[model samples]
Target: MDEINSVKIEFLSRSRNESFARTAVACFAAQLDPTLDELGDIKTAVSEAVTNCIVHAYPDSLGRISVKARLFGDSSLEIAVRDWGRGIEDIGAARAPMFTTGGDERSGMGFSIMESFMDKLRVRSKPGRGTTVTMTRRIASRADAR
Candidate 1:
Protein backbone atom coordinates (compact mmCIF):
# COMPACT_ATOMS: atom_id res chain seq x y z
CA MET A 1 0.00 0.00 0.00
CA ASP A 2 1.14 3.50 -0.74
CA GLU A 3 0.99 5.21 2.62
CA ILE A 4 0.50 8.94 2.46
CA ASN A 5 0.40 9.41 6.19
CA SER A 6 -0.16 7.40 9.35
CA VAL A 7 -0.78 7.98 13.04
CA LYS A 8 -0.98 5.85 16.16
CA ILE A 9 -2.58 6.84 19.46
CA GLU A 10 -2.72 5.03 22.78
CA PHE A 11 -5.14 6.12 25.49
CA LEU A 12 -6.89 4.80 28.52
CA SER A 13 -9.93 2.69 27.82
CA ARG A 14 -12.38 4.94 29.57
CA SER A 15 -15.89 5.90 28.60
CA ARG A 16 -14.92 9.54 28.39
CA ASN A 17 -12.25 8.81 25.80
CA GLU A 18 -14.77 7.64 23.25
CA SER A 19 -15.38 11.12 21.96
CA PHE A 20 -11.69 11.81 21.96
CA ALA A 21 -11.01 8.76 19.87
CA ARG A 22 -13.75 9.62 17.42
CA THR A 23 -12.82 13.26 17.01
CA ALA A 24 -9.14 12.45 16.68
CA VAL A 25 -9.79 9.99 13.91
CA ALA A 26 -12.07 12.42 12.15
CA CYS A 27 -9.51 15.18 12.36
CA PHE A 28 -6.79 12.94 10.97
CA ALA A 29 -9.09 11.86 8.20
CA ALA A 30 -9.74 15.51 7.35
CA GLN A 31 -6.44 15.57 5.48
CA LEU A 32 -8.32 13.86 2.67
CA ASP A 33 -10.95 16.59 2.66
CA PRO A 34 -13.76 14.09 2.63
CA THR A 35 -17.35 15.12 2.09
CA LEU A 36 -19.50 15.92 5.08
CA ASP A 37 -21.31 12.62 4.76
CA GLU A 38 -18.04 10.74 4.58
CA LEU A 39 -16.73 12.56 7.62
CA GLY A 40 -19.89 11.65 9.53
CA ASP A 41 -19.48 8.03 8.58
CA ILE A 42 -15.88 7.98 9.77
CA LYS A 43 -16.82 9.63 13.04
CA THR A 44 -19.66 7.23 13.71
CA ALA A 45 -17.57 4.18 12.91
CA VAL A 46 -14.75 5.37 15.13
CA SER A 47 -17.15 6.06 17.97
CA GLU A 48 -18.56 2.57 17.83
CA ALA A 49 -15.13 0.96 17.79
CA VAL A 50 -13.82 3.04 20.67
CA THR A 51 -16.98 2.54 22.70
CA ASN A 52 -16.64 -1.19 22.23
CA CYS A 53 -13.17 -1.13 23.71
CA ILE A 54 -14.37 0.92 26.66
CA VAL A 55 -17.43 -1.20 27.34
CA HIS A 56 -16.57 -4.73 26.37
CA ALA A 57 -12.82 -4.80 26.69
CA TYR A 58 -11.24 -4.49 30.14
CA PRO A 59 -14.64 -4.38 31.77
CA ASP A 60 -13.29 -5.05 35.22
CA SER A 61 -10.41 -2.56 34.98
CA LEU A 62 -8.95 0.02 32.70
CA GLY A 63 -6.49 -0.93 29.99
CA ARG A 64 -4.85 0.55 26.95
CA ILE A 65 -6.74 1.21 23.75
CA SER A 66 -4.76 1.90 20.63
CA VAL A 67 -5.95 3.49 17.44
CA LYS A 68 -3.85 3.38 14.29
CA ALA A 69 -4.92 5.23 11.20
CA ARG A 70 -3.33 5.44 7.77
CA LEU A 71 -4.06 7.46 4.67
CA PHE A 72 -3.02 5.84 1.41
CA GLY A 73 -2.01 7.42 -1.83
CA ASP A 74 -5.27 6.13 -3.29
CA SER A 75 -7.15 8.32 -0.82
CA SER A 76 -8.27 5.22 1.04
CA LEU A 77 -8.12 5.39 4.82
CA GLU A 78 -7.54 2.46 7.14
CA ILE A 79 -8.17 2.59 10.87
CA ALA A 80 -7.38 -0.05 13.46
CA VAL A 81 -8.82 0.04 16.96
CA ARG A 82 -7.02 -2.29 19.32
CA ASP A 83 -7.56 -3.21 22.95
CA TRP A 84 -5.58 -5.33 25.35
CA GLY A 85 -8.52 -6.73 27.23
CA ARG A 86 -10.75 -9.75 27.41
CA GLY A 87 -11.16 -10.73 23.83
CA ILE A 88 -14.27 -12.00 22.15
CA GLU A 89 -14.87 -15.71 22.45
CA ASP A 90 -16.85 -15.92 19.30
CA ILE A 91 -16.07 -13.60 16.42
CA GLY A 92 -18.99 -14.82 14.32
CA ALA A 93 -21.57 -14.13 16.99
CA ALA A 94 -20.03 -10.79 17.91
CA ARG A 95 -20.35 -9.47 14.39
CA ALA A 96 -24.00 -10.40 14.15
CA PRO A 97 -26.55 -7.62 14.48
CA MET A 98 -28.09 -7.35 17.91
CA PHE A 99 -25.67 -9.94 19.24
CA THR A 100 -24.09 -8.42 22.28
CA THR A 101 -22.42 -10.04 25.22
CA GLY A 102 -22.55 -6.60 26.79
CA GLY A 103 -26.06 -7.31 28.09
CA ASP A 104 -29.31 -5.54 27.33
CA GLU A 105 -29.67 -1.89 26.26
CA ARG A 106 -26.51 -2.17 24.22
CA SER A 107 -28.41 -2.46 20.91
CA GLY A 108 -25.55 -4.78 19.81
CA MET A 109 -25.19 -2.90 16.55
CA GLY A 110 -21.58 -1.85 16.95
CA PHE A 111 -20.10 -4.27 14.46
CA SER A 112 -22.99 -3.96 12.09
CA ILE A 113 -22.83 -0.20 12.09
CA MET A 114 -19.09 -0.23 11.63
CA GLU A 115 -19.39 -2.59 8.70
CA SER A 116 -22.09 -0.53 7.05
CA PHE A 117 -20.28 2.74 7.43
CA MET A 118 -16.87 1.51 6.34
CA ASP A 119 -15.93 0.09 2.99
CA LYS A 120 -14.19 -2.92 4.58
CA LEU A 121 -14.13 -4.32 8.11
CA ARG A 122 -11.90 -6.99 9.61
CA VAL A 123 -12.02 -8.25 13.17
CA ARG A 124 -9.47 -10.38 14.98
CA SER A 125 -9.78 -11.62 18.51
CA LYS A 126 -8.57 -14.38 20.78
CA PRO A 127 -10.10 -15.19 24.09
CA GLY A 128 -7.86 -14.14 26.99
CA ARG A 129 -5.91 -11.94 24.62
CA GLY A 130 -7.40 -8.92 22.89
CA THR A 131 -9.23 -7.69 19.80
CA THR A 132 -8.28 -5.53 16.89
CA VAL A 133 -10.87 -4.11 14.54
CA THR A 134 -9.69 -2.78 11.23
CA MET A 135 -11.85 -0.67 8.96
CA THR A 136 -11.13 1.00 5.66
CA ARG A 137 -12.92 3.48 3.44
CA ARG A 138 -12.20 5.36 0.23
CA ILE A 139 -12.72 9.08 0.56
CA ALA A 140 -15.04 10.80 -1.89
CA SER A 141 -12.64 13.09 -3.66
CA ARG A 142 -13.60 16.63 -4.51
CA ALA A 143 -12.65 15.92 -8.09
CA ASP A 144 -15.44 13.40 -8.21
CA ALA A 145 -17.91 16.19 -7.54
CA ARG A 146 -17.07 17.99 -10.75
Candidate 2:
Protein backbone atom coordinates (compact mmCIF):
# COMPACT_ATOMS: atom_id res chain seq x y z
CA MET A 1 0.00 0.00 0.00
CA ASP A 2 3.04 2.25 0.11
CA GLU A 3 6.13 3.00 -1.89
CA ILE A 4 9.21 4.60 -0.38
CA ASN A 5 11.23 7.28 -2.12
CA SER A 6 14.80 7.75 -1.03
CA VAL A 7 18.01 9.64 -1.77
CA LYS A 8 21.54 9.08 -0.57
CA ILE A 9 24.65 11.24 -0.71
CA GLU A 10 28.26 10.69 0.29
CA PHE A 11 30.45 13.68 0.90
CA LEU A 12 33.78 14.45 2.48
CA SER A 13 33.80 14.99 6.23
CA ARG A 14 34.43 18.71 5.90
CA SER A 15 32.83 21.37 8.07
CA ARG A 16 31.63 23.25 5.01
CA ASN A 17 29.57 20.32 3.79
CA GLU A 18 27.36 20.39 6.84
CA SER A 19 24.89 22.85 5.38
CA PHE A 20 24.81 21.10 2.05
CA ALA A 21 24.03 17.76 3.65
CA ARG A 22 21.02 19.05 5.52
CA THR A 23 19.78 21.19 2.67
CA ALA A 24 19.92 18.27 0.31
CA VAL A 25 17.82 16.17 2.65
CA ALA A 26 15.36 19.01 3.13
CA CYS A 27 14.98 19.46 -0.60
CA PHE A 28 14.37 15.79 -1.12
CA ALA A 29 11.75 15.77 1.63
CA ALA A 30 9.91 18.66 0.03
CA GLN A 31 8.12 16.28 -2.30
CA LEU A 32 6.19 15.04 0.73
CA ASP A 33 4.66 18.48 1.16
CA PRO A 34 5.91 19.10 4.66
CA THR A 35 4.87 22.33 6.31
CA LEU A 36 7.31 25.15 6.85
CA ASP A 37 7.86 24.21 10.47
CA GLU A 38 8.23 20.53 9.69
CA LEU A 39 10.71 21.31 6.94
CA GLY A 40 12.73 23.51 9.27
CA ASP A 41 12.74 20.82 11.93
CA ILE A 42 13.99 18.24 9.45
CA LYS A 43 16.69 20.58 8.23
CA THR A 44 17.89 21.34 11.74
CA ALA A 45 17.97 17.67 12.75
CA VAL A 46 19.82 16.74 9.59
CA SER A 47 22.30 19.55 10.13
CA GLU A 48 23.10 18.42 13.64
CA ALA A 49 23.61 14.82 12.59
CA VAL A 50 25.83 15.72 9.65
CA THR A 51 27.78 18.20 11.73
CA ASN A 52 28.49 15.51 14.29
CA CYS A 53 29.92 13.28 11.58
CA ILE A 54 32.10 16.09 10.30
CA VAL A 55 33.26 17.46 13.65
CA HIS A 56 33.55 14.38 15.84
CA ALA A 57 33.90 11.49 13.43
CA TYR A 58 37.35 12.01 12.00
CA PRO A 59 38.63 14.60 14.52
CA ASP A 60 42.11 14.72 12.97
CA SER A 61 41.59 13.53 9.39
CA LEU A 62 39.20 13.65 6.48
CA GLY A 63 36.69 10.85 5.98
CA ARG A 64 33.40 10.13 4.23
CA ILE A 65 29.97 11.02 5.57
CA SER A 66 26.84 9.50 4.14
CA VAL A 67 23.29 10.81 4.44
CA LYS A 68 20.19 8.98 3.39
CA ALA A 69 16.59 10.17 3.42
CA ARG A 70 13.48 8.16 2.76
CA LEU A 71 9.88 9.27 2.32
CA PHE A 72 7.18 6.74 2.95
CA GLY A 73 3.56 6.58 1.84
CA ASP A 74 2.30 7.55 5.27
CA SER A 75 3.63 11.08 5.01
CA SER A 76 6.61 10.29 7.18
CA LEU A 77 10.32 10.77 6.53
CA GLU A 78 13.39 8.96 7.76
CA ILE A 79 16.92 10.29 7.60
CA ALA A 80 20.17 8.57 8.37
CA VAL A 81 23.60 10.17 8.69
CA ARG A 82 26.52 7.83 8.89
CA ASP A 83 30.26 8.23 9.30
CA TRP A 84 33.02 5.69 8.79
CA GLY A 85 35.59 7.60 10.77
CA ARG A 86 36.56 7.25 14.42
CA GLY A 87 33.56 5.95 16.30
CA ILE A 88 32.08 7.21 19.51
CA GLU A 89 33.39 5.83 22.81
CA ASP A 90 30.47 6.69 25.08
CA ILE A 91 27.16 7.35 23.41
CA GLY A 92 25.26 7.88 26.64
CA ALA A 93 27.47 10.72 27.82
CA ALA A 94 27.52 12.19 24.36
CA ARG A 95 23.74 12.37 24.34
CA ALA A 96 23.68 14.18 27.62
CA PRO A 97 22.99 17.90 27.56
CA MET A 98 26.06 20.11 27.24
CA PHE A 99 28.30 17.05 27.33
CA THR A 100 30.69 17.60 24.51
CA THR A 101 34.09 16.18 23.73
CA GLY A 102 35.10 19.20 21.69
CA GLY A 103 35.53 21.43 24.74
CA ASP A 104 34.52 25.11 24.55
CA GLU A 105 34.09 25.14 20.82
CA ARG A 106 31.24 22.61 20.94
CA SER A 107 27.92 23.04 22.71
CA GLY A 108 27.32 19.28 23.00
CA MET A 109 23.66 19.74 22.11
CA GLY A 110 23.62 17.93 18.77
CA PHE A 111 21.87 14.78 19.92
CA SER A 112 19.50 16.71 22.13
CA ILE A 113 18.47 18.95 19.29
CA MET A 114 17.98 16.02 16.96
CA GLU A 115 15.90 14.18 19.54
CA SER A 116 13.63 17.15 20.12
CA PHE A 117 13.00 17.90 16.48
CA MET A 118 12.33 14.41 15.20
CA ASP A 119 9.69 11.89 16.17
CA LYS A 120 12.32 9.19 16.57
CA LEU A 121 16.10 9.28 16.85
CA ARG A 122 18.40 6.29 17.05
CA VAL A 123 22.17 6.45 17.27
CA ARG A 124 24.56 3.55 16.81
CA SER A 125 28.32 3.64 17.08
CA LYS A 126 31.35 1.49 17.65
CA PRO A 127 34.61 2.68 19.16
CA GLY A 128 36.75 1.93 16.10
CA ARG A 129 34.15 1.40 13.41
CA GLY A 130 31.94 4.50 13.15
CA THR A 131 28.63 6.09 14.10
CA THR A 132 25.24 6.37 12.48
CA VAL A 133 22.38 8.62 13.55
CA THR A 134 18.93 7.78 12.25
CA MET A 135 16.04 10.20 12.63
CA THR A 136 12.38 10.03 11.65
CA ARG A 137 9.56 12.56 11.55
CA ARG A 138 5.93 12.48 10.54
CA ILE A 139 4.74 15.35 8.37
CA ALA A 140 1.35 16.46 9.62
CA SER A 141 0.79 20.13 9.11
CA ARG A 142 -2.21 21.72 10.81
CA ALA A 143 -3.37 22.77 7.38
CA ASP A 144 -3.54 19.14 6.31
CA ALA A 145 -5.52 17.88 9.26
CA ARG A 146 -8.77 19.03 7.66
TM-score of model 1 relative to the true fold? 0.97
TM-score of each: 0.97, 0.95
Which pairs clash inside model 1? Answer: none
State each model's CA lDDT, in order. 0.94, 0.89
lDDT by residue for model 1 over 1-146, one digit each (tens)?
A: 79989999999988899989989999999999999899999999999999898889888899999999999999999999999899999899999999987888599999999999999999999888899999999997899878
Which parts of model 1 are misplaced by more than 4 Å?
none
Question: Candidate 1's C-alpha lDDT?
Answer: 0.94
What shift in Å separates residue 11 of candidate 1 from its native position after superposition? 0.4
Candidate 2 per-residue C-alpha lDDT over 99-142 given as tens digits, one digit per residue, 9 for 90 to 100 = 99888999989899999999999989998899999998988855
